[model samples]
Target chain A: MRHYEDIAVGERVELGSYTVTKAEIREFAEQYDPQPIHVDEAAARESVYGGLIASGWHTAAVCMRLLSEGFLNETASMGSPGLDELRWLAPVRPGDTLSASVEILDTRPSESREDRGYVKNRLVGRNQEGDDVISWEATNIIGRRP
Target chain B: MRHYEDIAVGERVELGSYTVTKAEIREFAEQYDPQPIHVDEAAARESVYGGLIASGWHTAAVCMRLLSEGFLNETASMGSPGLDELRWLAPVRPGDTLSASVEILDTRPSESREDRGYVKNRLVGRNQEGDDVISWEATNIIGRRP
Candidate 1:
């Protein structure tokens, strides 16, 4: 398993991809962000978006899924204390394929805890056209290997 | 519908609440977080947390849901450009009831767009014990009444 020591600053990793679907978008919106632009096609058409758009929360969650599957499982991850910033730069629509990429921005061992280190990662989710739909800076706590 | 002029800085509003459930936590984790501490009960018990914890993303989404139900439905919101910060200060467990509160931090007319304004709000989600589980600063674009 990759430990805190195994990661390096500026190292980039390809996280995985997910295809957004109309049904899933509506389902997610219905449960978590039931905005008309996210849940109703007709209403979305009349909104500023001019079409249904996946909730930003849904896109962010998809990025988390990709990250978990791609790296967290193989690492000594200790979860996160928080996110620094998050933005929805563009809209994600049904049938759009989104991919994630992560870059290690910085790392430092915790002074209060000897067993873990903190890593800052910049995560970006791009649409099929390579346009960024979501971007965030996440800080994760990782266990150090003995 | 409430417009940009309707919200005042420092105004606090009750967003709403949601009760966490075991099945819902697992289901959300399976789709978007899949970390052992989030998805598998036994593994979570063996982890540092000593019990299953809901994914922070799930908690954030619940906060979004509450915000939508509380105010978005009655407001001329044009969606958000981004969030300044998000933190999961405490663990959320099954059967734990969560609630949200929103305080408008700032508001200004859009410089480039006369039709809309920008609003900054601090959203906090607390558990049954009144401990904050999730908190964030959100900036939303709101339409101005004609």
Candidate 2:
């Protein structure tokens, strides 16, 4: 597993892509969001989005899945404190394949703990057409090399 | 349904509550996060949290469910543009009941659209002991009264 000292600022890692399906969108929204625009296709067609669109939270979860598969699983990742500047730039429609990536912005050792550090990164997900669908800044704790 | 003109700045609304179960926590984590601390009880017991904790995203989604049930369903909510300042203040453990609320911070008519406006608010979720677990600021589009 990659440790804190193994990662560098300015390094960009490509998280694997995910193609969102209509069934999955409805399933997620039904349990979490339950908004008409997200769950009911007939109602969504008359709404601003003109059709069913994935909930912003669902889109975020999808990005998280990709991040876990491509990056976090291979790192000495402790966990994340939180995120900032979460923006849903565009609607994610069904069948839209989203590609995600993260750029390491900074890395700092914990002032109180020598065994771990914080790594800040910018995460972005783009649709097949290259339009940004979601983006955020996240801070994660990573263990150091022993 | 409540329109943009019906909402005012500084109005605070209680968004009901939800009790998270251990099964649900692991289920959510299995699909989206799947981190050891969130998924495996044994591994989580040895981690900093000392037990399995719900994924931050899961906590956020629980908040969403409450928000949808208590607030958005009654409003002329067109959609949301985005959000900012998302913070996970504390770990959400199994069987923890979370209560959520939203305080309207500001309201403004759209500069270009006469039919809609923007409502900005702060959303907060607290555990049974009154400790904040998650909070964020969100902006939603609301339709004006005809």
Candidate 3:
């Protein structure tokens, strides 16, 4: 398994893409968000966005899926403390394909724990039209090589 | 509808609680996070957490549901730009009931737009034992009264 020692600062990895669907957007929104712009197409059209849009949380979850498939699955990931910041730069609409990527910004071995370290990365998702849809800086705990 | 003019800084609101289920935790993990500690009981038992736990995103989404039901539904919420910071303070496991709340921290009228303004709030979720499970600072766009 890829460990903390195996990764370095400045490394960038391309995560796979996901296409948002109208049905999935509505389903997720119905459960967690339920805002008019996310769940009701007609109301969304009358609102500021001018069309139905996916919930920001849904977009973040999609990016997490890509991160798991492309990077975290291969590593000895312990878990994450949380994110430093998150910005929904642009609206994610139905049928928009979002391609995601992560760039390692920094890595530091734990002072109190020898078995694990922290890896900081910047994650960004861009739509089919090349506009950034979401971005965040996250820190993950990765186990050291045994 | 409640508008930007209706809310005041330092206002605190209690969002309702939610009991997380094992099935729901695994479902969200399998779809998005899929981390072993979050999805597989056996694997999680061998991991540091020693048991299955909910994905951080799932916990955030649950909090979003409470926020929407308790507060956003009553206001002229346009949408959120995003959050400033998020920290998962403690692990969330199956059967854990989390109660959420939000306190308005600041508000600013948009310089370029008379139709809307920004509301900044601190959101927090505490488990049954009163331990904070997650917290974040988020900013939302709220429409002005017509």
- After superposing candidate 3, which stretches have Cα over 4 Å from the reference? none
Two-chain DockQ for each candidate model: 0.89, 0.80, 0.87
Across all candidates, the chain A TM-score values are 0.98, 0.99, 0.99
- Candidate 2 vs candidate 3: the TM-score winner is 3
What residue pairs clash in candidate 3, if any at all?
none
lDDT of 3 by residue, B8-121 (tens): 999999999999999999999998899899998999999999999999999999999999989998999999998977999999999999999999999999999999999999
Q: Which one wins by TM-score: 1 or 2?
A: 1
lDDT by residue for model 2 (A1-146), tens: 99999999999999989999999999999999998999999999999899999989999999998888789889988888888889999999999999999999999999999999999999999999999999999999999998
Report lDDT (Cα) of residue A99, candidate 2: 95
Candidate 1's residue-wise lDDT over A9-38, tens digit each?
999999989998999999999999998899
Model 1 gets an lDDT of 0.94
lDDT of 2 by residue, B21-72 (tens): 9999999999999888999899899988899999899999999988887999
B3: Cα error in model 3, Å: 0.2
The C-alpha TM-scores of every prediction are: 0.99, 0.97, 0.99
**True-vs-predicted CA distance for residue B46, candidate 3, Å:** 0.7
Q: List candidate 2 segments past 4 Å from native.
A: none
